[model samples]
Target: MNEMKTDTIETIKRVLAEVRKNPDLAAAMTPSTDIVNDIGLDSLQMITFILSLEDAFSLEIDFETFDFDHLASIAKLSDYIAGRMKEHV
Candidate 1:
């Protein structure tokens, strides 16, 4: 894969590691894993997860521009991050 894609995947895994306390939830996380339905993350957990992601990537999340649906999957999250990164560049 290209560098950006590689970086996104690694970042996703690292963020998930920090946010997902349950081993089962972490283990079930794939590219298509749904953060709410599949991982069962509550609002507080979701906030922590997003905060972890923001810290991991050194970027501030603009909730207004961010799509809630993108949080559903690792791939989508990566894409969202990538898109946000592009905006800063």
Candidate 2:
């Protein structure tokens, strides 16, 4: 089944919580929120977040071509994920 972008966003929130568990996350979250800058994820946490997203979506991220620019914002990441998921399907 194809997942909606909203589902992707929600999954991101869940995965982020698992990785960071930031108390202010809910209040800080927005489509424009920068995944890296806003969340302040360390290198390890960032990797964990990516892996968790891959697992949650049941799709492997193409690190060979993955653009770190996608990490610039929540909307960008969500869009990239949705595109990747489509490719997987």
Per-residue alpha-carbon lDDT of model 2 for 1-89, expressed as tens digits? 23587777777877787789775575558777788888889999999999999999999999886898999987789899988988978
Candidate 2: segments with Cα more than 4 A from true spot: 1-3
lDDT (0 to 1) per candidate: 0.76, 0.84
Candidate 1 on 1-89: residue-level lDDT in tens? 67887778766766666676654444556778766677667788788988888888888888898887987777888888888889888
lDDT of 1 at 42: 77
**Poorest stretch of ten by lDDT in candidate 2:** 21-30
Pairs in clash, predicted candidate 2: none
**lDDT at position 17, candidate 1:** 62
